[model samples]
Target: MTSLFQFTGSELEAIKLSVGVAIYSSLISLPIALLLGYWLARKQFPGKAIIESLIHLPLVMPPVTTGYILLLVLGTRGFIGQWLYSTFGIKLAFTFEAAIIASVVVSFPLIVRSIRTAIEMVDPGLEDASRILGVGRLKTFFQITVPLAAPGIISGTILAFARSLGEFGATITFAGNIAGETQTLPLAVFAYMQVPGREIETLRLVVISVLISFVAMALSELYIRKMKRS
Candidate 1:
């Protein structure tokens, strides 16, 4: 069994890239998700449906389309990308940054949904009571609402992080799956499957992915249960 197997260095590089991208994606997305989620949960305004639809669109749209849109907006020749590269020498397309963006966009809906649900679960009466006491909007949100929503935020973030970890289509389309550069765990497994003599290595990666996902779910459940108990 060992004789037939040879894991290329690229495979390891892909795993590392995946982990880094996932971590970056989670960090970058968390704040945006929280803000959007809180807004959706707490506020009502004109064109809210449009904003909500845009936020959740990636969940239904093909990942390829999502990636293409990101490319169009963040490509070197694209507006934002060109300005960023020109002003800061920062290029996003086909790089780790692109991967993080793609992963975040794809996984954002999950985090938003989780957090929105959490925020909605908070009693509005409590917010009103805070206001009656002259608590400012910002202070009330940070001191009361966010704390009440912490359990939800944490679970949502965990879910988002895990989903980002396994993102494939958007990541590959935007980042180009370059080994040690943009390639991630899923890309590595796909690359291994494309060639001969790497089945065992591919299986190992599959097991690792499954294990990680299982652990994430388990931890989310534990956290939620603890929150409930408290």
Candidate 2:
């Protein structure tokens, strides 16, 4: 079955690009997730629910819709995109960078949910005690709150990366399927599926995608179990 396991150059490129995008998106989402998670866990205010709904909008909305929105906001002719291009000559639509943005947008909510739950589980008494001892909020958060929330953060990060890895609709719609530039593993699978006698190629990428997603989910689950037990 070695023959069946072979990956073409384009397929390998897709895998590499997917992994890089996943890592970048996860890193980008983590700090944002932490702040939002902490606030959602510890703070209450009017319009909080509305703010949360907005944050989690991508989770409920169609991926294509999300991509279209991103395109409108960041596409070459978009107002912001227009400003960016006029000022810096940058273009976002249908590029490698757009792929990363699409992944970040789609995966953001899952990261927030994971982190929020983790932070909420941490005892408020602990933070209060730290403040009573005159520890600065920043110090207390990094030293105490973060350590306690580590598992969830880790879990959330992994899940975010995993979501990025399997991202299809948003990435394709926003970034387009430019091989070695914007084409990811899922996109590669989709591309290969359209060709006759490319079943093996399609299956190979599908298998790789499944394996990567499975590993990420397994790791996330492990941390979740650990977080609960603590």
* Maximum-TM-score candidate: 2
Model 1 global lDDT (CA atoms, 0 to 1): 0.87
lDDT per residue for candidate 1 within 99-214, as digits (tens), equals 99999999999899999999999999999999999999889988999999999998988888898889888888888878888888998889889989877878877877787778
Q: Give the TM-score of candidate 2.
A: 0.96
Q: What lDDT is reached at residue 215 by model 1? A: 85
Clashing pairs in 1: none
- 222, model 1: CA deviation in Å? 0.5
Positional deviation of residue 7's Cα in model 2 after best superposition, in angstroms: 1.0
Q: What are the root-mean-square deviations of the candidates from the true structure over C-alphas?
A: 2.2, 1.4
Global lDDT of each candidate:
0.87, 0.93
